[model samples]
Structure formats: structure tokens, C-alpha cells
Target chain A: MESRPTRRRFMEWFLGLGTGLLAVFYGGASALALWPPAPTSAKLQDMGPVSAFPTGKPTFAVYTAGGAQDGVFVVSQTSGPPTVFDFHCTHLQCAIQWSSGASEFFCPCHGSTFNIDGAVTGGPAPRPLHRHFAEVRNGHVWVGGLSS
Target chain B: MSRQQGPDESRRPSHLSWPEWWAERLGLGASWREALYHPVPRRSSVFDLLGFMTALAFLNQVVTGIILMTFYSPSVAGAYQSILAIDAVPAEHFVRDLHYWGANAMVVLVGLHLLRVFYVGAYKRPREFQWVSGALLLAVTIGFAFTGYLLPWDQQAYWATTVGTAMASYFPGIGSFLQGLARGGDTVSGATLGRFFTVHVLVLPLLLLALLGLHLLLVFVHGQSKVEEALPEGYRAKHRTGDHSDFPAGDFQPFWPNTVATMLGSALVLVAVLVALAATHPAPLLQQADPLNRANYQPTPAWYFLWIYQLLKLFPGRLDILGIVGLPLLSGFFLIALPFIDRNPSTQRRKRPFALAAGAAAMVFVLGFSYVGSSSAVGPTAAATTASSQAIAHPSFAHNVEPLLTASCQQCHSASSHSGGLVVVSYADLMKGGGLGPVIRAGDPADSLIIQALNGTSQQVTQMPLGGQQLPQSDIQLLSNWIAEGAPDN
Candidate 1:
């Protein structure tokens, strides 16, 4: 009688353990499948020639980087490489406009303002305007992924 | 499964009717009659019919949704087109409208039912799991709405889903994983459509049916709550033994003719309202999704989610988790733990003042916020650009249009990589037409395919530049001007 009860107890424990392990395995596998893999970096795109932009002016340019449309303001300096700024405001990602007279980039959505150098000058912008990886290659302006 | 025969079973006829034959074979005849003719509280009124109305709304949705599935395509490329085709047929479009309006009615009915149950303290004692199951059913109903909203693949569907999934991705550790699971990838592509379709059509419905069965079964087992007085001592022991003779002699009524009639009558009224609303306002389908138009178009969540949308606006960056994940979890925990927290056995509304006050306040807050959220206007709030300092008589192809094409268009529409059989490498190549037809017609920007594609006003193709971003409005206007200048080869 003692042996029979002990064997039943053992069987119950074994079944419970087996069920628990199965549940854990399934849950973990499902989570792993849902989790995203490491993101791949964006490639560079040719964004027309450097000479096309007027010197000492914030000219607007649009290009596709990493399968996304990115509007940027390229302020062509009198000398050295130009400063390229992402068009969105740092506060909420609204499109930023260039005002040559005020010499500042204005985000009309919330009145956030950034200077021509991409520094946050006024309003709710938490940081400076975002920049793109830019380089002059064979007279053409190549823009890569976003650089914070 | 053998059992002692009850008095009703002993009087069965020698020859069974068709339904009785199948029911007897299935061993369900007596049980079915018992369940259908079970006693309910005599005080049950029209308000108690909320659950039945909700179930009826769900049934309508299932019928219409199955019919729609016969024609619906669960693919990004085909979803919008299929909806358009459905709209062309009057009967199908009306059916679609019924499904759309039925979803809203079901949500409201569920809310009303939950409110009734809470007010009457029906979640006490043995009915705790019943409330829990009802809560899960509420969640599944919402899941159905969220997944179904993405099936149309129009601009409203795409952008609203984008914002929704992005909000879900703000949870601390598992945020990104939630987004990936919901969207099936980094972006809302074809994979997202397929995933949402499967969840909306299959998974959620099955889960709902199971939970609903459990919830209804528990209701019958426990019997409806007696709101007139508190339970006497030793009630729990008697309840456990299935002795529900606590109610007064004449205060009980059978569920079949009395309650079922009222429930079905109210459901008929709900059906009439849905039909009238659907006939008056068929579901609106906006333009095909344009990823590039994000800056110009405002994405608003569905009406029921407006309160949460408005709440997010209260918290700034990083702290958005408070509005997104924190509040929802807190409220959900509170809802599930209500029975434990308020241990009072009294079913009287006056006895539960604190609970009633808290519930009332929450309802008011949601309604107020939803009002504020809905009143806010949507679409293209982007400020107009400052005029250019210098205005040229005409845009030059070499200096202006060609470079713009090279920067934005040439990636997909160049000589070596002509995506749609149209090349933008040269003015001549551009004028030569794609597989469809000439993309540009001289001096007519309105008719030009390229201009329409750029501005996302084309009915023939999806928005240009495939990615969910648009060319700056200024660049698009410039292109329109260039084409209007006769698309010169210069």
C-alpha cells in the first residue's frame, strides 16, 4: 500500500515537471521569434553636386537614405565642407523651415528655432538639430545615415 | 456519463423529433433545456440585456467579416485596391459599413455591461473569475478593432497604425519586441498587414469565443447577483453545494421566455440602429498610404483610443512611458484587483460609495479627454514656406529639375535601374514613357504622372519614393512648375 501511493506521487511529480518545462520552452521560443534583430546601418546616397548649392546660403535638399525620405538644409560655407542639418526639429520631429533674414531654422509646429549652425536657439527643442554623414566625393555631395 | 433520470426526462416521447433526436444522441437535450430555462432574478430589466446586445453585435460582425473575407486581400499591394473594388459594389459596401458600425456598437455595449456588473457587485465571491474573464473578453474585443483597422491600408489606416505601434515600442525592456511582433518587422510593410489579418480573423475570435463561454457559464453557475440585500452568513457553503434557494419564493423567473425575449428585443433595436448608421454613413476610405506625407498629415487614433492619445500629449519625451504603459498597467491592475480590494459583501450601491465615486471619476476623465481629442483638427498643419528671394521666369532642366531627379528620382528611375520602365537619367528618357504610358504630358502638371506621383495625388500608383517620406512641398511644387514649362530638354 505504501509503495503504490509513493509511485502515484512520483508519477504526478513527473507529469507536472514535464508540463512546466514544455510551457517554458514554448514561451521562450515565441519571445525569441518576436524580438527584433540588430539593425543594419544605412548606405550613402549621392545627393547631387556641391557646386549646385549657393555659397553662404541654407539651401534645402531632399534625398532617400536607408529607404526613408530625409529633407536636409545644407548651409554652404564660404570655405571648408558645408554644414548639413536634418530638417526636423529636435523637440517633436516637425519639418523645420529656413529663414535667411532671421538666419535661423524655425519649427513652425512649436516655434522652436535653431541657428544656421544647427544649435538650438529658442523654444522647446531639447537638443541641436540632427545631422547627416556628409562628404564631398568627386564633386558630388554624398549623404549617409543620421548622426546625432 | 449515466445518471438518475429526472421527472422531465422520464416523460419523453417514444419517437424523437429531428432536433430532439440529435440532441438526445449528443446527450445535450436535458442540459440544454436546463440551461435555457434556468431561473434568473425577477428584478432583471433592460439594463441587464447589455451582455446579450454585445453578443449580438459580435455575431453580426462575424457574419459580415466572413463575407468580406471572400473578397478581401490581406496584402499591402492589394488591400487598398480590394477595398476600392468592394466599394464599387453597393451590397458589399453596405455589408462593410455594417461591420464597421457593428464594431463600435459592440465596444459601447461591453462598456455598459461591465458598468452594470461592477455597480451591482456581481464580481463577489464565486463570481470573481467571471469578472476576470469578462475583462479578458473586453481586451479581446479591443484587439479585434485594432487589427481590423489596418486591413484597409489607406492613409488613415497606415499612419494611425504607425503611431500606435510606435507608442507600443516605448515600454522599458520589451518595447522593441512588442513593435516587432505587432508590425512583423522594422516597418509597417506587407508583413504587418498579414500579421494583423491573421490575428483579427482567426486568433482573436477563437480566444473571444472561449472566454465568452467561460464567462456565460459562470454567470449561470453563480446565478445573477441579488442587488436588494447582502448575502446571509453560511451563504458561501450553501453556494458551494449548488443550493441557490436564497431568493424569495416569487422573485425568480425562467430565463427562456421572460429574459430571452427582452434580451433579443434589445438586440433587435441595436441592429436597427447599426443599419441606420451604416446606411447614412458608409465607411470612408482615404488616399493610398504615402509614407513621405508624415510631416504633412496628422495621424489620429480611432475614436475609442482618443483619450489615450490626448493623455500622451500631456507627457513630454521619455516620460511618455507614463502615459503609454504605466497608466494602462495601473488601471488594468486596479480593475483586476477590485474584488480583492473591496471585500464588502453588500450589493447595495450606497454601501459602495468609494468604489462608485472612483469609477465615476474615471469615466468622466475618459469622456472629457475624448471630447478634447476629437475636437482637435487633423491633417497638414505644417506651416507654409518663406518665399524664395529670387524668382526665375522658368525652371531650368539642367540647373534645377535634372539635379532634383538625380537626387530623389534617379535612385529608382535611372537608365540602369529604371524601376517602372521609366528612366530619369536624361530629359529624352524621361519624356519617353514607362510601361503604363508617358509619365509627363507637356504643359499639364495636373495630368502628368510624375507630378501626381510626387504630390501623392495619383490614383494609378502608390505615393512616389516608396519609403514613408515625401519630397519637401517646395520641391514637389518646383517639379510641377518644371513640367508646366513643357518639360524642356534644354
Candidate 2:
């Protein structure tokens, strides 16, 4: 073992080290990519309180998450936390307009309408107005991501 | 230098080899190795490699599919769970992805193989069965995709199967029968899953293997037709009279070492690519199917079938008769009848202008249609900006005004026993008003006749819930509020 190394032996050792390093590098890279990657957290943005909204009328606010902006509806009836909704109509995605006297959200594109509680009330909407995440936390209603 | 040379002809290993000794002891000849792995004369070309690639793709699919099957459950209840479990296993997604990507590759490779055959005029007079069998194999490959799609039992799979089977019902006479056979009923049910699983696992594989065997046998027998040989006799006489030194036989390599080595290398490369893809983009699995919620999911067929889906959209209403049945039938007939119809057998691309143009045009048209189909507008008008991006979640319909109407009013104003011309069956009927007049003005339900009638404030109309106890004031207020809330059809 203590004998002087020949050129061939030194070359063999060098190539072996390189091959082992290559194998480990590839294995690690593949594992990082394929081995059930760490569960992803949702991209969320904070929108402030329910009390900021007036009772019996929807407060239209622009929710900007992931650099995309869209109108969101915040309705506070007997508020702890207001019911937050995607401000677009369920049927045709036109920005919904809440008529105070009529007490409903109407889509100008189509006649689709939704109740104050986000239920589709009329026209051709097959579902209710989509809701966003809103929860009462530390005296303030915080709205966040729609999905993970 | 010749591959056929032995170490020494006088002292051959064949006389004393273990294989020969075993063969003699077993009362069998020592020809098995030669029969199976004999030299292919090293004349392998891109066409041979393409054919080999297709077979490799098939082999990959079978290996991955079988491994997947060991974990796969065919029943409706178990399909999704099994998939989830398989996904949980380390590297299982890689195997499944390989199978998924391998399926697409198989279809593409088979297509390239066919195209290669067509260009070389290998589908000519003596080799007609090869073309026909290959066509049938293509059908079987697509059939495999169709059947395998339903195995996942997800919403996308379920609805795609529904639409696919429904389309089968449009063929003139045997359409219904075909639909029934595919579906195992009038609709997609547990039976459909059973049938699809059976076909996916047993039937298609059997058919494919048989056809592949026949296809390979014919190919070996014909020994891969040359471009010059594919030419018409007169054309061959005029342009290329002598064999080009460029021909394969001049260098003549053997298949055992050279071609097989390259084939193995390409196969390994293909598998590596599949692994990379699987690692990067695992095949997605949607939520398990909810049959009752069919309308909630958008159904799109696999990419290969997208052109037909796009065509269907182009042909609406009465034109559907032509789109669903006639168009596909015509194309299929054209494809199968190609060899016979285009008898001008000049394999040279320059010599056949019209045929090449027609083929090229068809390819462009199909590709164009597929591109449009996968990304085409689903409705005449777009609904939501996010609709195109992701699966559209169903909005909550639980709190819709319908429930209140159904509970409070339907008893008296039900369709069977309407007070006037009005029935409380649906939002439409309720909005249409009674025999008196329109009851609910969508946004202005407070002034609507139903509210007026319920409040007993209408002079002409009698109090609603006439025979029953008067509704709670809160319920009446709720009703009026809902009416004023635009009466959405949630």
C-alpha cells in the first residue's frame, strides 16, 4: 500500500473519484426533483377588516394576489367577519354591480344576479358567487388566498 | 473483416459448446440462438430504427403498465385510491409518467412508421397486409388510449369517456351497438369501468400483440422494400437504372452487433428522457368522478383526438350528423384506401407532386385542427378570465332562493296544481308571474307579485299559503329580500 503509485494507478483513482462524484450528483438532483417535493404553501395577500365595510351594501375592493388584480366583494351584514366573494358574476364573469334599492349583485354582460350572501338568484348562473378566504383574527377580518 | 468468419473453421466451438451439448441431450437442435438472433445483414436504416423505436415504445408501455397494474384497482371505488397510493410510492410517478408519455410516444412512433412506409411505397401490391395490419394496430393503439383513460376514474376521465362513447352512438346502424359495447350500457357506470379495464388490460394488448407479430413477420418476409423497388416499372427504367454504390449492401453490417447496439442506446436515451419528464412534470390526477355533478367538469379528449373534437365544434346542430359520423368515416376510409388509390408507385418524392401535396396538406390540416381544438374557445362567448386557466370550481348553490321557494311555495303552486297560469316548479315559472301578471321583476323582487301576494297586499290576488298557516314574518321578509337580490338561479 505504501509503494509508489504508477501513472495508470493514479489515473484509475482519479477516474473512479470522478465517476463516484457524478453518480452522487445525479442521484441527488433526481431525488430533489422527483421525490415528492415539499408540500407547497399558497401565495397569499392580506386584505384588511370587515368593519371597514358598510352594512347591507357590498364594498368592492381590488384583490391583487400573484400580481393579478380583480374586484372582490365584501358584504358585512351583522359583522364579525364579512362574507368575501369574487366580485365577478358566477355566470359570465362580468364585474358585478350591487344595487342598493334592489338588494342584489347584477352582471351587466348578462342579466345574472346574486344575493347579498353570494347565492346565484337569477339569470343563467349555475352556481353561487365564488367566495374568498376571510376569517376574523385579532379583532380584524383578514382575507387571503382562494386556493393552494 | 467479414462478420461471418469463425475463430477457426477446423476447430469450431459449435461441436463442444454447452448449448450444443444441452441441445443434443434434450433431443433438440442447436439452432435456437440463430433462429432468434441471426444477423440482419447490417443494412438497417432510419426506417428500420423507426420501426424498432415504435416497438421499444410499446415494450416500455407494457413494462410500466404492468407495474402500474400491480398497484391499480379497476373498480370505480378503488381506482382513484390506488392511483393515490401508487403516487405516494417513491419513483412510482416516474413509472406512471413513463407509461403516460410512452403511450403518446407509441402513437407518434407508429404514425412515423406508417408515414415512412407510405413514402417508401412499402405498402405496395405485395406488402398490402403490412399496411392494413399496421393501420389496425394504430386503431388498437388509440383504442388502448381510449380504454386506459377511464381507468383513473377522475372527473376528466369520466366525462371524456362519456362524450367519446356518446359519439360512437352517432354511426348509422351499428352506432348504438358500438356505444353499448364500449359503455356496457346507455351511460358510464361501474360496468363501463369494468369493461374499459378489461379491454385496456386484456383485449387491446392481445390484439396489438397479434397484429404486431403479423406485422413483424410480413416485414421480415418482405425484407424492407427499397425506394427504387417501390417505384413504378417505367419510372424505375428511366431514372435509376443501376444500384448506387451508396446502397447499404456495399458496407453490409450485421444486425446482431451494430444495429442492436444502436437500438439499445436509443432505447436507453428514450427512457432517460421519459425519466426526466416524469421527474419534472408528473402526470396529474384530478378529483375522483362525481357522476351527479357531470356538468361541473369540462371534458376534453387526449391530444391525438383533439382534431375531431375541434371539428365537432365547427359542425353544430344538424351539421353534427356529418361531423360525428361522416367526416371520421371518410378520413378513415381514405387512410385505409391510400395504397390502392394512389397506384402511381414512384417512391421518389420529386416525381410524385400531387400525392406529396395531398399528404402534406392533410398533415398540416390535422395539426392545425389539433392546435385549435386543445386551445379553442369552449363557448361562443368566454365566461371567466380564470376559466381557461384552471378547473372551474362549482359555486355554492346550497343557499339559492330555490330552496326557500321549494319549501314554502311549491306545495300549493306546484306544477300539478297551480293557482293560476303560474307554477312554482322552476325559477323561470316563478319569474313568469301568475295568470295575473309577472310576479318577480329580477332585480326588483320587492315589487314582484309573489311578494305582494305573500304579504296579502295585492288587491286582486288572494293571500298565498291560503289553506296553510300564515308564513312567519321573518320568512316573508327573507322571501322579499331574496326576490330583491336579483333572484339568482343558484
Candidate whose lDDT is highest: 1
Candidate 1 chain B: worst-modelled 10 consecutive residues by lDDT? B382-391
Instruction: Give the per-residue lDDT digits (tens) of candidate 2, residues B380-445.
Output: 133222231221122212353555466557767888888787787876787777788888876674
The TM-score values for the models, in the order shown, are 0.70, 0.55
How many Å off is the CA of B294 in candidate 1? 7.3
Report the lDDT tens digits of candidate 2 across residue range A61-126. 666643334457777758456778876554423345554334566653334567888887755555
lDDT of 2 at B272: 84
Stretches > 4 Å off in candidate 2: A1-148, B1-47, B227-250, B377-490
- Output the number of the TM-score-best candidate: 1
